[model samples]
Target: MTNDDLQFAHDRPIAMQQHDLLDRAGFAQRLALAISSWKNQESLVISLTGSWGSGKSSIKNMALEQLAAIQGSQVIEFNPWQWAGQDKLSSAFFEEISRVVQRKNPTEADKQLAKVLRRYEHRLNAGAAVLSGTAKWAPILLGSALVTTALGSVAEGTAAQVTIWTVSAVSWLGSLAPWLKQAAEWCTKRSKNLDQEAKDSELTLSQIRAELQKLLSARQKPLLIVLDDLDRLSAEQLKAMFQLVKAHMDFANVVFLLLFQRDTVEQGLQRAGFDGADYLEKIIQVPFSVPAISSGQLEAVLSGKLDAILANEQQLQQRFDKAYWDQMFQRGMRPFFGNLRHVYRYASTLAFHCRLLRGTEVAEVNAVDLFALECLRVFAPETYADMPRHKALLTNNEPFARQDEPQRARINQVINHLVFLAPSTHKPATRQLLQEMFPTLDWVFKNTEYDRQTQLRWLINSRVCCDDVFDRYFELSVPEQDVPNSLLHELARRIVDSGPFTTLLASHEEDRQAEILQRLFGLVDEFPLELSLAVVQTLLQAGDVVGRRMSFTNWSPRQQVVRLLRLFLLRHDDEAARSQLVIEAFAVGPGLVVVEQLLASEYALRRKADFGCLDDAGLEQLKSAYLCNLRELAERDPEAFLANPDFESYLYDLNRYGEGGDEGRRWSERHITSTTRFLQFAQTLVNTRSRYSGDGVTHIDEISLHSLDELLGKECCADWVARLDTGELSADASQILGLVKEALAHPARSETAEWND
Candidate 1:
């Protein structure tokens, strides 16, 4: 079979037949020697104690295998937990011993041994029968005696009472005589049987021991009985098994190997009301606690499992070098290796994800980072949850000012909790390790300066562990039939080839098309300049299929295109390049959406305390470009521009006066220069209104008056005044002129006079 066909065997605890992880400590050989040296002696109980998954069972199996190779040794395997609810633990154990002994030596002496074992069984059964009889009759007999005594106490001084009592006593005696006689006969028979049984049991014990001694002497090998999974038994059953082995089952030439996790078994014993340590000490002659696996051994086993799972995947090997693996193992996975099952769990998780993402053309994902993440996912799930939630911070992409203090503190709490939950020796190292893997965490939690170089190196080497890659991983991890990776790959290829994105969208269902578009949207952020341009162009071209008005999250396809193009353009410092991209986007459709997006970015920059990384000149250039694009859209399609919902909002922004400074003066000057178009648009509104008669108001009158008021102090106000004086203005404009004159005549009082009123 191929190596790939070979299942990841270490996914579970290594079984006894599999000695791969067992031989590392040479436990089998050492234990075998210990057992071999105890030749035909009195019963020896050897307890292998370790934490769960610490290779106790594996060691026991190895030792048993070693014993199997020895001459004249007989091994009996018993699982007390399996027989737990089926029978009494002691009976099941003794029955197993008797069966094993019979199977080992089926001769005339063996028949005698069997007879002795039967006598022992009978002795236990007879005692149990006596106890059962007493439990059954004791309550009934006591109740009857209490009733008779109460009657005797109450029976007072009258002849009728005496006669009644006498009759009742007679009747009771007549009824009780038969039962008493039966009880007497039963006790007599039972007493006789007990005496005979005692004599037989004593003789049987002698013969059984003698026969065992002879059989063992002739064979020259000790009997090895391996009892495993005692921890799985209930508390009562575990205690009974221990008592049975310690009290009745101890025989010469016999060795009992009890495999258990010390703490779990001890807790069970304590809960069962026994002094666990003292009780175990009395029963276990030789206690061998399996030493922890060394770091070197753990590393070897983990690396071997990784190699097996990653075989034939050369790209992963190239990306995940020895140094990378070492860093992840030492930092993230090392602490988990106290138990070998942890190694299997993490490796299996990694292998599963690797196989999932194997041939897909995903973003560059470092194998070590994936493995480290899987370690967190498996061992520290709360911490793993924070990885995705605070991904931008962890990857050093989030701005310092934007970092959530509570979220940062929460992440620290999770890390500290994990460290505190770890072994004491490992706490410091674990904290350091997590800090190294996520350096931004050091900055957030420890207030240490972020190591940009180190973080950048990790980003370059292991992008998959970060936020963007994680998003993509989850996107691709879904079934191909559901998400269709091949279709996404095809879309990417077509985008590079400048193929029609609309054609691609037309082929899929609406929801599937949306999924493809969203995937492409994320890809735009990851792709390079050329590929990003191709993606934006595809989205623009797909307007036909997605429809010009098709909106998601309240954004049209054109708006989304504008959003992506703006992000792509900002990456380039070359103004000419950005302008060219803007022009190309504007050349398609009316490009009003692009203008809106640019204005939004400007407002965002204006709100930043330090303008982020952009200087005053860069900010000016962006704002200028925004206005220039808006002017182009207005000049190209004035009606369409006026009809836009943001048209009034844009005018308001242009007329806005900034707070004091050189910047404020510059903004005022720019607003004055930009009002020429505003005056012309105001004139259109004035002309649209008919001559007003009486004092009736109209929509055009309100529009004209509001526009004229907005231009009151600007350079465009004079042009409107000249129009009113020359009679070129309509009656509505003339009315606004009268209001302006009134305002000028009485500055404060005229302002209070409502023209519409």
Candidate 2:
């Protein structure tokens, strides 16, 4: 589309070709006729007041357009902000007025009026300059005046007073003469001929008024000078501009329409220590505020923009059906639509991103989600920043930590701030919009719960919100190339179809394969349960494909597969399925690393109260599978198994299970194999005392004693206990053996004793 096609109604005031959407109150028509039908009233100042971006400019433009059709009316548009920092506002105002007045067919009377206005302007400048100079030396001038007055008064007093005052005057004048002469010369150089200057200044306000009337008497139309964007001026400039219109711009047959955001200009005046309300009341003879835009009108305008952008894309357009569009408009876009400018800004951002991202083959993005994200990005940037950084919280998959409470509170505060800051009528809907955008916030706001599937669907559709779908949207550098969406879709289809894993692997480079697999794994969480199960099953059966690509990096194919399994087990609430999956993974020989991953996955689920995935039977089965794998590894290559980095965690898991439940006893018995191996394990624990010095000692001590007691009768281990009493063993070893001896001596009392002791 061309730039003109892309422009929204509010991008510029309703052009000649553009229809008026904001003249709902007929304020523009009334305003135009008001200016056109002006009688011989003194120069009138009419103010069009509204908040910034509240369609004031558009309304003014519409009124001016209407005025164009009125017979004999001449309109001049002047923007004070345009001349900002250039010259005094008063001087610029008169210059513009003169320029406009002089352009009335160049009649002799118009020429005289322009010439007289310029002369008034020059005289005003000269007077200001003279006053500025004189004010600078007022102290010296005052001192001389006081001295001369005292000398004159002394002559009427006693002889002694007269003599004293004469002496004082002489001393003061002797010190002040050089400064006085310099001040006089400064004034003389700046001053014009006194008599002629007075003659030029003879143009009084009344005479200027009469001359303006006489000049406009022959004209067929009234004069309308529209001054807009006054709020854009600096505080000093704003105050000066209004003051100039009040003092000098008042004339018969001329109408001045001043447009600005009321609060902005009033605040500017207040900042400059003026009674802003009173000042405005005096300057503006007729004040009219742009009425609020109706929802029907706003929706019409927004729909127009949306239709223009979506005109060519039937598929994208279908996504925004009537009900969906209405909901989104009322819930998302409508509340934030403060004015035409707001609509333009939001629509522009939506159009820009949609144009850039539409029809991309690599990412399966939803158009509505993209629009919602852009809305947040533009109107509520802080909320947007928080959303992506805390996605887990938004999705309710994770809770905010104690340390994050402050930030959570801040995010809530910002949301609340935006809610209150929104228009009062829209506050309720705006709050709902925020909750819809970030559902995790509902815990605090107590809003309705959004459908998780729908939320995830929307999230995955936008590149900004879904990191797995595409490269970071806000990153500074651009990617060299993006993976095609068609390729990703095909890869997913193949995996779902139970196609050969190596076929997929052989088709792409290792890195690309890893990214493809990662993206596939991302779908397990975003899609439904059946689809997720299919993805998990595909990964499970592709062990050889994954193993070949395993590397030290965390994102290797094996790790990706392992993570997908963990996510599946954690995310699905079926305990039997999770148990079966764990059993199958171990049965397939998923190495010691995958075993540890399974253990961690279960532990996290239990910790987060998300353990619906593994029931009692499933738990027993998972624990059994875990112990049996470790037992075989220990028997096959004990040293390598013990030397594995995950060994301690495995041991900890064993201790955790053996301390409670029937499966604990069976797990310990099945794993402890022989007395010699039990003793060897006990010895290993002692040798690694420093490693288990802190909280580790508790689990190690308990497990060591329990294993020794179970493998050998409690009484038969007396010799082992004696080795500890003889102090031949280290403190940690002795500690465990001593606990065994105590247990044999008094089982009940020892059971009650703290493990640390």
Candidate 3:
């Protein structure tokens, strides 16, 4: 996705010091040292507890690594979560420990003790299996009565199934007296033998217990059984596990190290019908709370991961300042990370997003802004979710649009409610993070707001606070037709080369072409003078292409360029410098469309006095230049000049600037000799409007004779009309002439109809 190959950070625990970015080894070393020195001959259950993702498992691993260096200690990991929903976890756990002790270089004596322990567990297991066993449907004949009943009660006691079956079969043969006598004697003899064996085997459980105690005491090394992820178990599983540990408290030289979140385990214990506090208190011989990871350590972990990822991405690194990142982390981002897990989670998420955005798009966005916003997204999703909906209020600097009090209040209410999702300790920092992104949002709490430059810089730098670039961040791709500021800046820089820029602009669809001009106009209004001058110059040349597609109405890209010119001119207080800049611009011959636009604006200013930017002498200079440029164009290409869409406007400006009296008509006569040229001239004088009837009929209004006489001399048009041969004229030319002369007598009043665009 990017040239810089960003890597994801895994969420697993750090098993070695090289991966320990949080500096947790010191604490783990102390724990291992304390346990190794303590000579507890009997069984001990030590709990190393912390909250979820607080590195409880990591610290346990570190401590065990240190303990492995000691002369006489062995570690065994027992995972009770995997054995959940089983019928005999207790027996399974005993069998596991006994197998471990026996398999690890055991002596003859150890072998005998392990064997006895295994046998005892098997016996208990067999007893439990018999109590739970299912029996098929069967009937028993008891003293001439047939009974169908469950044998569960008898299964639980000493009454055996084999003995009952023998009695039942012998009763069926009661007619054979000798066989009945033999069956009765055999049952009595079997019962006496079972009684003798039961008396002899009464000490089996105690004997196995004594044997394990003796064997563990004689061991050269202490057996350290480590159990992790205990908090992940269900209520019933937690109860079973704690009961197993409680049952084995009498074993000498055996130590069990338990790792879990204390609260979760307690909650599960309470759900399983035990006083969680008391139950844990009885079983836990040594308890140690995993040290609270400091905020600095958490920040270090996050920074390390981010730095590693950023090191791979050079574009981000070029813009990254350690001082700024540290400051932002301290003020807002630091509070979002509460543990090592949070750091890894955020790093992995950031890496994935950075990789998803292609290089150009990544370069278009500011790195710090991306980091802060991504921090919001990962740690506080609900707060981030509300951001894009209020893009206008957050980014728009227009004075009128920003005065929506109700909308601002709703945003304020939403921001204030963000505290509910965040922890109490980090709520203020969370608000600060938002305020930093949207300075206008500060008005809610700080009674102040940022000025336009702050917002402008955000737009120019492609920060999420800028409205145009904001959605690109959330959507993770640039819109197809939209122009990103990166490419726009490049275009502005290369505007001096009008060849490529004009060609590229023309290649787009008409709407997108207008959109490019719109963006350029904004740049002309706000960019530095050096670049703005080049951009306005380029727009003037490009406007001819865009203006051809436009209806010369409100959405005219040509009109937007004029407005930008006004904005630019008004920015300079000196009339001379501004007028000189515009004249020089016109001197370069930026086409007829833009020249007429400026001159027309000056005429409007003279009538309404609603604008500024040029003086009378400057206007005369511009008029002289336009006249010279206009004459040269007519002399250079007469047919092309006459066929131009705005032929009427160009001729009017020429006559207005000309020494007067039929100069434009005489010039038009050079090219308007044929019906084709006359038809093109008539095309410029018509207006179309929707009729007032409900049937949606449109009426084409034409200029009256008097108006035509004022523009073109009456004698000039009368002579031309007399000279035209009706037979030689094409059908289209003849129709246009009829329409032109049809309204000459009545003189229809032409309204300034709005363009459909």
Top candidate on lDDT is 3
lDDT of 1 by residue, 1-757 (tens): 3624534445454445565554533776678778777775678899888777788777766666666666435677889987744235556665776687678546765555556565666655555665655455454345466324423432222334434443454456566655544543444445555556656566554565565556554445676788998888888888878877876444666788899988888889999999988889989988988876777788788778888766745446655667766766666567766667877777766766776655445324566666666765676565555545556655556554445677677667766765665456555655665665665565576677645344434444444534435454444354433444345555656764434555776676654565455545444434566655555455445543453334323455445455545555567777566555554544553444445455565567678743322345544565565566555654577556555555554554455522231332232234433333434444333322333568873533333334344533433455545555754655655665655554444555433323321
| Model 2 lDDT per residue over 493-541, tens place | 5665435544765567666666656655545554345665455556555
Tens digit of per-residue lDDT, candidate 3, span 1-757 = 4555555677888776555666788888887776665454778889999888899888887887788766547667888887856456767776776787678787897687667677667655655543343221121223332112213323333436535754665566566546445544544454454454455357677786786677778777677888899999999999988987888887877888999999899999999999898899999989989888887777666767777777666656655656656667777777777788888888888877765443552365667777888888887787777777767766644345554578568667767876456667667878888777666566765668666545545565566776667787788767665576556666555566666767776777775665555555445444557554555566567667664555433356666556656666767787777778777766674756876778887877888967556877897787788788888888898888877777777787777768765677767766677766666777666555445567776765554455456566656666656566445777867766665665453454332344322
| Residue pairs clashing, model 1 | none
Best by TM-score: 3
**What TM-score would candidate 3 get against the native?**
0.80
Q: After superposition, how far is residue 49 of candidate 2 from its true place, in Å?
A: 2.1
For model 1, state the Cα shift of residue 436 in Å.
6.8
